[model samples]
Target: MKKIKLSFDKFKDSTIYLNSSKSESNRLLIIKALSEKEITIKNLSKANDSVLLKNLLESENLVVWDAQDAGTSFRFLTSFLAIKKEHVVLSGTERMKQRPVKVLVDALNKIGAEILYLENEGFPPIYVKGKINQVKNKLDIPGDISSQYISSLILIAPLLEKGIEINIEEPFYSRPYVNMTLNLMNSFGIKSAVKGNKISIKNQEFSSGSYIVESDWSAASYWYSILSISDNINNLTLQGLKKKSNQGDSVISELMKSFGVNTQYKEDGIVLTKIKLDTEEIELDFRDCPDLAQTILVVAAYHKIKLKVSGVESLKIKETDRLVAMKNELKKIGCDFYEEGNYWILEKRRREIDDELSIDTYKDHRMAMAFAPLASKKSMIINDPDVVVKSYPTYWEDLKKVGFIIT
Candidate 1:
């Protein structure tokens, strides 16, 4: 196992070039495929997700796409293939196989796709028999499930002979994700509408177009965490983030205000400055933005702040059981993460940092990257550092740009 040990006494000011958003890049790849027109995308994500999307689009005949733990690839391609009606076996890493795809499979079945669960129900390695004609326009898909399923269907909606209308049952989670899909669709000359838990897209061919991917807002949250705990915030300038971003994790700008990070909008990106504020206990429903859970939890624990979090049931199905990972690791740093009915509370009982904070990444990229920012407070080692290739391939390099020494 390859491990990267990060030492941080204090970091100096330096300019960092962050990777572009894999989410946007993948969505655009599907759009371009539908458009069947050649276009140039600038600053595309170098992460594995974008790489898989690019490769799969170019490959033909008996393709075994090693998604390498890219969830977006597993899902977006699943729907993309259903539209093209190509016979392919979609599989990923062992951990990816464990991630449930039953929701998407069932939805695709309703739309007339021949899909069989290869190994087990609700898991990967599904044999998809693609190319079924006559996908109905109106359908009921669960809203509380992974938004990837919804995004998958929406990406192909415009191509269907009958435009698709999705009726979302129950309160939707990851709403920002659905909105991000719509925003990207619009950029590619397609539009969608949401009215009372229903999203409708009219039948229209996607236009071939070039798209510029913004820096990942999810990646920026780590810097927000470091700035929240660091004494000097004047040095951190996160570039390529937009004030108006489709990424839902941009809520970090508003949520981190309570943690003492003042946000400033710039033409290039946003600047985070430390401010004077009395930290207090807070509560939020993260159902709309589950990806932000780890960054917020680490920031809360490192600051010794009390926090109540909800809408985290999806954490169990992510790259790792994030709730369990956080609970176990936070205990090493003298913090207690416990569940109370529908809420999980982070109680900071002590200020003592473990002399050498050792972390297990559990093959989850976020686990390694999210916790690494805490090293700004103390020295730490992250196991399985390469796991970050799932999203931010340059994560460790970007940290080094900010004066973090990795050995």
Candidate 2:
């Protein structure tokens, strides 16, 4: 396995410009294609996952697409290709195959899609023979599972003979992501309405227009973490982000405030400034913004703050079991981490942290980047550092710009 050692000479005041949101970019790409209208998209994400989605959508005469570890691309394409009336196979990396797609496939099949599992009953490597007839327009899907499935189906809803109505069962997670999908759909002239647990989309046409994606708030979490744990107050500017964003991860700004990071909205983007720490114990519910959980946990661990986190049940099904990964990895840094029922707790250990800790990424991009901020406190080695390319391709480079030495 390839690894990189990161150490900081000194934390410097710097301005970092983040790439566009991959979440928004991927959704727009699908809407643009479904519209069959010529639309110009500006400031698309440079992440490998978004790039792969774009390439797959533009490619012709392709039989199979290996989505690697991009769960969004895999799920989004599964529905997108199902409605295209083509014979294609969608597969992914080894770990990706372990991620379940049965819920999505079953729903698509009920809607007249021909999707068969090539290997496991509830996993990847599925054969998608496009459906010619619409059998069902209404679906009952569990809300606790991945929201990508719902977004995938909803993105193709307009193309169906009769638009889709999805009844999301109670205990919903990532509601903001579903809202993000609907909001993006609205931006393209497709209208959707949500009443209680049901979301209804009509068979309307998408309008052709120019879309400019906002900067990724998820990617900015690491920077917020860096500022949270820094000893010296630093002024950091992140460009292209908005005070009001469709992305759900925008909650990072408020969450980081407890850790002493204050945010100011500027004309171009937002600026981060370190302030006084006010809380000794922090508690967060991550149901709507699960992506920020890891970064917040790492910050809490480093700052020796008692943290209680809930609504992270979905972490088990991500690119890796993030809760388990964080529990195992944080132990190496002398942290007491455990989960009780729906709540996970992190506390500092009596023992001193190891001088040179080696973190295993578990093939999860968030794992690699979330723990990277710890290097500002102590030098550490990260295994499979390239995993960050899946979401933030320029991660290491961006860290380098702020005086992180990677070798």
Candidate 3:
């Protein structure tokens, strides 16, 4: 389908069982791969990213594993393949080939894993010789802030014979992601330490155990966006989301408060109830939660709220150039994200959502779901709606359950 129009209106109440966290699922799968014994992981994400990573890890004969557009899968697999010492090539989609892999590859090589970039010097589609000599235990990488890079290295650290210590240079973004990785590694019985821009994980066997995945809070942000702006909604419940979660994107609960979405945390999930907007302006830093930027930006733009945000510099290298994409797409809705000093401001409240509004997803899943809620304001067409499968595979179905007509 070239485009799908979402015909939506008011709903009093609806419930959706949110998808499992691909973040947690992917990390655990890598841990499982490194484990000496089998471990059971419940509720792995159906997201294309996690599914691809799981399949690639399980395949023994495939010589070239295609990571497609999944950044986590590609970065994590790069490290995992090097550790397995498997002679194979790691590749991805055209855009994936453009995304940087040198940080992880260089770090892996420093620690004695031989990896060569098959194409560009810093990009992916790399050949992994899987010849490990265990040369070094310490690595120094720029902290310009890709949590995936740090997570990839840390996840494989335990498997290193000499263990590993990483010194992250300052100006680090996404600390929460690095912490999530360490926390998961600890849960698997591998102890680690973090001290002021440094991280260390000692060599240890991954303990066998069963772990359940939390519902994707990143996925839940879309519902929050819908409820925040949808006047016809009385109640929207998302199942399987925990008040306390290892996922960094769980911050959506706090950030959505300004948009008048009240979250009542439940034993099994979360309920979103609409409330009166409490403020005219909001300020946020997405360094630790970059994935939520698109959702929040969309919500802010839709309402013509003055939102001053930083930590979004990382968005440039995402699935698409999100900053540019946001600028262009938001332009369609009569909003602007112009720079002001160090922060970008979403001001000049002139929201003019077109009746024939059609949003291009730029091959970015967040772009598709973040802007989906705008349909509540006006029925609109979403291009490349299938992109949501990268994270929230059931996004469209969930929307349909809430009285959204897709045709």
Candidate 4:
């Protein structure tokens, strides 16, 4: 229950180094397990989520995993354990249990994997007993929901005798993540295909091979938010992102364009420079990259820009009830956010800069990190600052590199 107090600080021209990407690390962990050749990954993410996933994969015995607050670990491990034929009780913190797993469980059951919800139906605190002997070669799961479930099944698909045939129920959100899973799997020598919404995999043993994870595009979004809010652009250079990235959040590059941050591709990573602001009201869909919703929402409110957003239904089941968190936290900062059917509206109003803003993170990493950039505009404090450990453990340290004041 640690709290961090942050104050407003102007960005002075400085060189900053950010940690590696957790998104890539988690995706790679599944690939490494499926690889037939011994694989070594470099520049892996140091986030607690990545660390937790690595430890769980290496653990032996009666494992009662405390995944902390990482939803990916929870979802991925559920599928991983089912395939291993091991008896494991997978659970998480109170917030984690509240997140839904029923969508994933039903899919696994259809594939002849035996899984039981220990307590609430469709939520966590799940029990995965020994594996079922049968494997259904072809199955259908909704793709419009969390793609973590799809990745979970894809990771263990190689080990199945019948392999897998996944029919995604809709056009799909987070297609890049599913593709990232397939791309990583191919790197490990197991090829899969997606035609329309139908994805098919052949049961081939994972051949071990080495692969490197790309830095996180999702983490880079915070820097974009900070640059948009700050008048100084000379103080920032984000490293390890690609101009062309498999990460769906790569759309952040184009999204930030509306906020006046121009991204430049370098050999090592991407560099962001602030540009002129657009006076037009902003409208965007978060269906593909729902995680970026909070960061974009905060930036829009700070800039006094009117915003309309959709494709955020998944927010309700994330690390926290993000829609509710945003609604409450934004109220604290003198702005209003409300859902009008499918669209979310942000009404902008200028407030006194001195009105001490204290944000409640609701155990969501994005909630804490997304709001942290607002410190550039005015001094603010975040409750449970440690919540960022779930995704980006070095978030506060990286903020310091950009000249943020933390105490």
Candidate 5:
């Protein structure tokens, strides 16, 4: 395993430009393939996840698509391949195989797509034989599981022969991502309507046009963590972000304000500056933006802010068991973190910070990036720092520009 040691440095005023949103890029790739007319996408993400999805979609003789722990790729591609006329196998890394796909598989199977698990039940390494017979046009799926599964089915909804009507059960997690999918489909000339828990899309052909992906708000969360815990009078600018974004993680700007970080939107991007801390205790429900949970948790721990978090039960099935990973790793840095029922609480303890706390990434990109911001407060070594390539490939490089010493 490879590790990168990061140490605190004097806060520097720097402007860091971020890559395009991988979430938007992956959806656009799928929509582009479904469109009969020519479509162009600009500012696509350089993240390995987007790159892998793009490559796999463009491949001519693809027998096997190895997503390699890119969950979005696996879920989105699973639906994309389910409606095609070819036979393909979708598999991924060891960890990806452990992530559950049965919910999405059963949903697709209910709609007439043929997909069978090759190894374990409710997991990946599945064989897909695309021949949609249109058994059912309506699907009812539990929204608490993963929004990617919902987005996957909806993105291909217009392509289905009979179209599709989806009823996402209550207690939906990551609702904004589902909205992003529908909005992206709308941009491509497929109109969808969401009434309460029901989303309806008719059998319409996608229109070709140009789309420019916004900057990744999820990637920006780490910078928010860095600014939130930095020393006095710190100001950092992030480029290519919008005040209004389809991405749900844009809520980070408001959430970080609780941690003494303020945002000022400029024409090009936004600037984050340290401000007065508002509350002693913070309670957040990440049902719509679970990706920001780790960044928030780490910052709250560093500041010793009492935090109560809920709506993260899905974290157990992410790239790794994130909730358990947080419990183990945060303890190494002098914090007591645990889960009670549906809530995960973090309360700082009076313990000395380790001289050199080491964090294990567990092959999860968010874990690596989320904890890297902690180096702004203390010296730490992040094992498998390269894991960030899954979404934010330029994470460490951007950290260096903001005055973090990585060696």
Candidate 6:
């Protein structure tokens, strides 16, 4: 669908079955590949990225792998290919080609894998010549780049001759994602440890096991946005979420509390109930859970909450330049968002809501999903609404369960 219009005054408490996490799913898929016959994955994500990775991993006799717009797939596949010693080219969609993969490539080359960029020097569309006769394992890398780069290297460390040790520089945000990777590897019988900024993994074989991916907290953030600003007090049961999750975005449960949404953890999932809000300002750091920046910004703007957030500069290299996209879009709704010093601040305006609000998705799934919740406060049109298929395929339908009107 090119666009969808959303509106709802109120709806009954309902259950929404969240899909499994694409982050965990993609990692487990790599772990499975390493184990070969020793592992099985349950509830793998249906996100386009995970689906493409699954299909490509299962395909045989293929020399060229096209990862499309799936950035995670390309990075993970790059490492996977290097370890398998496969001599082939890994390419992706136009936008994915633009995303930088050189950090991982350089680290891989240092450890004896030959990877060369076929297009731009620091980006994708690369030729992989597999593992070579060289010996190197310790790498010192900057922590500010994508966490996926750190995780990509960690995932392949166990197969190398000397294993690997990574020392991440300070000013590191998004540490939770890297932790999730190590935790997942541990579950598969791999031994790892982190001392200060140094992450060390010893060479070992993956043991036989099964991994169940939890419900995506990133996907659940949209629901948190929905409940936070909806016209009335509505309760939503987010199925499959847990009180304790390794996923960093699970912080949404606590963050939404600032907006007066209480989370009650249940055996089957999480239930969200809204209460009265009296807060005017919130200061947060998105460094660890950058994905929630857009979703939380929407609530802050709607409530006229003064928001001071940091660690979101990384959003520039995401599906789009989210910082610029958000700045441009929030203006339409009368909120002024700009960076002051180290913090990006959102100042709410005292104004009448336009009869209808129109939101552009910028081809970024989070942008579309984050603003759709505004319908609970005002009817809005979401251009490119289907971009949500990147992570949450049933997002609109799930919103419908909570009485959101989409046309």
Total residue pair clashes for candidate 4: 9
Candidate 1 Cα errors over 4 Å, as ranges: none
Tens digits of per-residue lDDT for model 6, 112-180:
888898889989899987664448889998898788989999998888879999999988879999999
Q: Per-prediction TM-score, please?
A: 0.96, 0.97, 0.97, 0.95, 0.97, 0.97
User: What residue runs in model 6 are displaced by over 4 Å at the alpha carbon?
Assistant: 132-134
Candidate 3 yields a Cα-based lDDT of 0.87
- Relative to the unseen true structure, what is the C-alpha lDDT of residue 393 in candidate 2, on a scale of 0 to 100? 93
| Residues forming the 10-long window of minimal summed lDDT in candidate 4 | 8-17
Stretch of 10 with least lDDT, candidate 3: 5-14
Candidate 4 residue-wise lDDT at 328: 92
lDDT of 2 by residue, 1-407 (tens): 99999988866548898988999999998888788777888999999999999998889888998888889999999998899847889999998999999999999999888898999999999998766368878999998888999999999998988889999998888999999999998888888989998999988888889989999999999999988886643878999999889999999999898988999999999989998886789788999999999999888887778898898988998899998899999889888789877788888654666767899999899999999988887889999999988889999999888888899
lDDT of 1 by residue, 191-268 (tens): 888898899998886667677889988888888887787664455788899999998989989988888888899999
Candidate 1 vs candidate 5, TM-score winner: 5
lDDT of 6 at 214: 98
- The lDDT of model 6 is 0.88
Task: Kindly report which residue stretches of model 5 are placed more than 4 angstroms away from their true locations once superposed.
Answer: 11-13
